[model samples]
Target: MRKDWCEARKNDPTPTQMYYAKNGVITPEMEYVAKVEMLKPEYIRQLVAEGKLIIPANINHINQIPMAIGRAVKCKINANIGSSALASDINEEIEKLKVCLKYGADTVMDLSTGGDLDEIRRAIIANSTVPIGTVPIYQIIHDIKDLDNLTPQIMLECIEKQAKQGVSYFTIHAGFLLKFMPLVAKRKMGIVSRGGSLMASWMMKHHKENPFYEAFDEICDICAKYDASLSLGDSLRPGCLHDASDEAQMSELAVLGELTKRAWEKNVQVMVEGPGHVPFNQIEFNMKEEQRLCHDAPFYILGPLPTDIGAGYDHITSAIGGTMAAFHGASMLCYVTPKEHLGLPNAKDVRDGIISHKIAAHAADVALGRVGAIERDHAMSDARYKFDWNKQFELALDPDKARELHDESLPQDVFKEAEFCSMCGPKFCAYKISQEIAKIECNDYPKEKK
Candidate 1:
């Protein structure tokens, strides 16, 4: 007779570092994360012990490159890529995933609401070297054509299936309670989150509590079994600047805080998701509020876009807010592509979004003075002053774009090392001119040779 894992592993230690850390033991995951973060394994264990940091490596995500997310680690960014009801297939979604990972997305979410959700998720998860996250309610809605008929058990089952398949984190919207539904009536853009709106709708139709909230304990058990982290979704997050930091958002945040403690109680790693759109002046406040309310369980924010008018250039807007959010205390940024507010992002949009957030996260790391964060910026400036174009390209966030743009006007091999780029065309290059001026100053001070 074969024993089930529960019985067979009864005496064996859990793979979750939190489980191990709480017991004052450091597992290999802790050791690997220590090397990746450049901190000692013992220190990593301590942070995990305090619940100040999270390492979202599911035991089944065997190929994952382990990473830590919290105040202690370098700021991280997540890229969202999945098929919508209209565009993209499994291949296209996977292609986008490749672009996201290539461009430095710390994690990826398969937000597919169309065509074979399982197939798409499985393909992405099977090939993903980074953690894959998803909103399981989407699949439940897909399976149950009638929203009114959907049951709590169905939602939990679908999510458990994914968790078992190696989803490192989940965006469960347990915070969107029925009472909060009334507050959204006054908002400019009501219920912008897909998962948030769906949960609200189910609540309204059934006249009941949010199922995810009702089943929070069970969700914790499932996530813990697989060592998956919880990214408690902010379903009431503001969709526009005017709706930001409003009562609805804060109320849900309070609930998320409660859930965070509960998830921690079971040793399930938790990170709280935050705002949709917010003004620039208020971005820091949002970060602080979430940190305080959620007890700093690694806040992950979606742009908190400073302005609403950037439909075509939301990636840039996201970068601006993302930099500030991370600098203020956010641990992870969900990349908002140029196609935001318009349509599903394509391959280029994914690449563009990842690159933008990479800039934001790195800028935040530099601002926070994370070790070795400023070295690359210093190196780039030095390369420019010395006309080391090759080194400059290497130091660029999107090196391909940097190389391509520079080569557009100066395609010659000799220009690869030249002090001037097409922007200045040798004659007007500021760095080149500075070098010439320095030579003149040296000649004028030749008496130093005597």
Candidate 2:
């Protein structure tokens, strides 16, 4: 069934069906995703028309399954896993991928910076069932002998290579123009994104235009050919609350607005990647600006980590910001693990990051009134009210952990037939007292009335 859907997307009999989205037609991919999401086909089309939902299905990636991102559907979560130059291990990275999948990550990005980049990417692409994304600039930087040797052509070639390798989306830092460099140079963190910093350094050394900016249309053509979606990266996103929504970030955003229109003109799907570290108050403004300026392209964000502190607990900080961001209009969240600032995350960190973002996504979905979001919560509430421990555990996000925590303080043997557990103990249990009071009132109400 999946094969037929993918083949039809590539070779549908319709004459002008270049990309499924360009023809103003609904393809099998759309139908499949709509069914999975429990949304109507026309609603998916409407969101795609407004540039709110993005379905990243590359023609070459026959194994690629379709997923939607927009206001009308459940918010999606993405897990980023890859080896760095300082530390590289293929097995460990694969383990992280397993953890991401196990914890329900909607998508994964192969940000591998070391250990035969091509091999690592191929392995990840082969292993991933969900849509995969890549930052092409990372490979271009890793390949160059010296930073000065990098050129626009090298960067463009990297993008093409990855697209052919079946990357569903590409994070092109085309907004980091040479003109925006001076502004970043004057900032506290300079450039926070690795790709953004590399481009900035290269532009400064050569005094030339940003290759991606200068060749934006050509890049769009490549994306259209493969039906690969473009994730317009925020090269000037604020790295701290102090730098939130400044002129530099807004200037790059303006450029992205122009770029987004150009991509749509070529009939290519596009999304905008947002901030690094924004405060709680500014997340909504950032979301609104992306929607207004970029013509409502799906807004994918990285933590936007409300504050700079909480190194070991950045997951919580990110979840707080992520919920607000999604509620305000962001569609996809890039999970930020505990080791965000310190180092690469292990398997446990991946699970923690995905779970945190999953919670944020569910909360936002409920607020948005997406189907089934509230139903599960209501079911869990009913189970709790009935004192049904088994049902409660079954409905929990982390059932194993929930079961373990319940067993820790309340031994099953000691409280075999009791209606309450420890923490309040039997004497002080509120629910038990309430149950007793309800029975007494029921028995005395008739006699008192007589």
Candidate 3:
């Protein structure tokens, strides 16, 4: 096995501090990510110092590339593709990963819960050029013959194994302590997160403290050594609008707040993951509370799906919530597929989910005044006005799909003469009529009635 990069750098201050203490020094990772994001190094450094952003670059994971998550950059989108015990096809999962990447996902998480968890994780890490994140508790719980078999040592071993495999970040459900489990027992969804549910069940069954929470500092030490970012999981996130912003959720968030501080102190990069389902009215409050409570660590959120009724259209619901969440200061939007609350997402569902979240991320970037957001929109509008079909297709979030749909709607032969599209046809082409009127009015007008 390779030596841990973070352990080699452990004698030095943390990456954030390294940036803050600087005399204009920049790491290669910082420079590369800055160029990709079109932001200055100093600006990125400032956000890091303020604890409003994170890059999740594990030193051990040399193959793991860097991407910024913060207010100052383009909002980032994360696509989750993984297998479960009930359904584990490694090749299908890889195809889904490709689909996400092709559709413009900024990051990917392998939430696989079956089929040689270690092998699946290692395969993903090897194939992924972008940072890969995982929930270590899944493996821990999956390995147990009985729920009662779970212990702190088993959990830590799983985390260490993944860390060794070069997982850049981990969604440690350390916030789900025994003290907070009772609060969630009365929740509407009652622990919707798989990791959360597993831990909760283990704690309730054994009548013991959550090992992850009880040994958080130890977990931090291990993570810091590997330079893996700790994504403090929201074990009690509201699973439906009815449960949005309830006491149980807030109670777990309070624990996450304290844990966030601890992780930062250990120089472990940290982000807070949030809600499963939240109403439109409450999304802003949830974002604000997360920033306030988590000390402004980068906020990663799931759909927070505004309503629970859109079973087949949950992607739309998630995008709606995601746009609001991002605009309100959520740093990362985890794409939710139509299969949400239904079944495992297939490749098409993954693509649809990624494209929807991409739209939400870009929309939020435009709203937040990020560097290139509005310019792209204006460029697309120009393409539309000029009837530049190629340019318009190129500007789309999913260019292939856009072009395919355009072909289906209007074949090339039909519009060969005029710049008008099939949607308007020849008789009612608004642009054509507007142009004709402009020419006639300009040429036939009488001296402006002077």
Candidate 4:
């Protein structure tokens, strides 16, 4: 279906959504997003034209379903699943992708640094129904083992190669400037971002500016050709609580802001990536500052884990910060797994990560009162009150897990209509008692004389 749509727009020099929106032409993608967001197509076009929202529907990614990411829409979630140099492979990554989609991940980034890079990415993109993103530098770095052999031309080629292969977006670490090195040197956890560290290494070794920044225009041209979006990577994002909202992070953000305008000038879509870790109190500031600095180009953020102590449960920590981040202004939340800072995640880790972020995103949407957001919560409440076990399970974010927990004690079909769960038996069930009290007639109670 999307191939047919792309075929019709092949004559346009820049077929990007931004181009269409700016020209007062509403594409089918805009209408699709409008229906999903419950807003008018004109409103979606207006937001895209102003660079506030992005619909990452790459022309080459014909199988992809269009999704809108912006402060005005329901907060989205991204699951990072890929093979490492030491563990995982294409099949495992694909399985992880299935889990991601099954659990409601809004986007998926193929961060595979191992196996056959081209084959792995091709397989992932071919199979993905959601927008697929990649950090082009990973494959470039892996293909060229020696940093000395890397060139700006090589970087552009990698980006173009991936874009041609139907990658919906690229996380370009172009905003990390050489001037920020001095500030990074004073940080507690200096340069936690993988892309940031790689850029910093190249800059320090060459004693020159970041190559991504230098060739950003050419990269934008590639994106415009394929209607791919640029997620300007926050290479200087804080990696720890002490480094949260520091000078280095803010400086890189300013560069991202400028890059956003440059990308927009070329009629390319853009979204700005944000922090790695941030304190609870600082999440709001980080979110708002990104909107202010990046001109509302759909801020996408990582866990921004509120604390540094959660080793095995960074997903939970990230959820805590993610809720606050999305509630404030973040358009998308990147899931963090239990193996974060420990090891590469497995399929189960991906599931846990996706569910955690989904909870966070939905909680934020409910808090913000987005259209129909609270309806699910009300339905869940009604189900619980009526002892509708099946309804409650159906309403749960993870229905299988919810049913698993409930069936741990009473796995029989008879318990499906029970008024109480494992936590409270029928004798002590409040809902059951309330039902009994409501059944009594008003005449049964003694009344005082007026």
Measured by lDDT, the strongest candidate is 4
After superposition, the stretches of candidate 1 with alpha carbons farther than 4 Å from their true spots are: 1-14, 437-443, 446-450
TM-score of each: 0.94, 0.92, 0.92, 0.98
Ranking by lDDT: 4, 1, 2, 3
Go through the candidates in order and give each one's C-alpha lDDT: 0.87, 0.82, 0.81, 0.92
Residues 1-450, candidate 1: write the lDDT tens digits: 112322433454455658879999876777878887778899999989778899898777777877889988999999998887787489999899899888889999998888998889889988888889888888888888778878878888998999888899999999999988789998989999988888888888889999999999999888888888999998989999999999999999999999999998899999999988999999988999988898978999998699999999999998999999999999999999999989889999999999999999999999999877899899998988888888888899899998899888888889997767777777898877777777785557648545
Q: Count the backbone clashes (under 3 Å) in each candidate.
A: 0, 0, 0, 0
* Candidate 2 lDDT tens digits, 1-450: 356655554644321112445546777777877898998887777667656788886766667667877666788999999999888888888888878777789889999988788888877777777888999888887888577877667777888898888888999889988877668767887778887887788788889988788889888877877778899998888888888888899999888888988887777788899987998988899999988998888889998799999899999999999999999998899999999888988888888899899999899989988888899999998876667777887888777677788889875754534567667777888877877877785556656545
Q: For candidate 4, write residues 205-252 as lDDT tens digits.
A: 999999999999999999999999999998888888899999999999
**Model 2 spans > 4 angstroms off:** 11-18, 410-418, 432-443, 446-450
- Candidate closer to the true structure by lDDT (higher is better), 1 or 4: 4
Better of 3 and 4 by TM-score: 4
Candidate 1 vs candidate 4: the TM-score winner is: 4
- The best candidate by TM-score is 4
Candidate 4 clashing pairs, residues 3+ apart or interchain: none
Candidate 4 to native Cα RMSD, angstroms: 1.1
Off by over 4 Å in 3: 1-25, 413-418, 437-443, 446-450
lDDT of 1: 0.87
**Deviation in angstroms for 67 in model 1?**
0.5
> Candidate 2: lDDT of 339?
90
Quote the positional error of residue 196 for candidate 1 in Å. 1.0
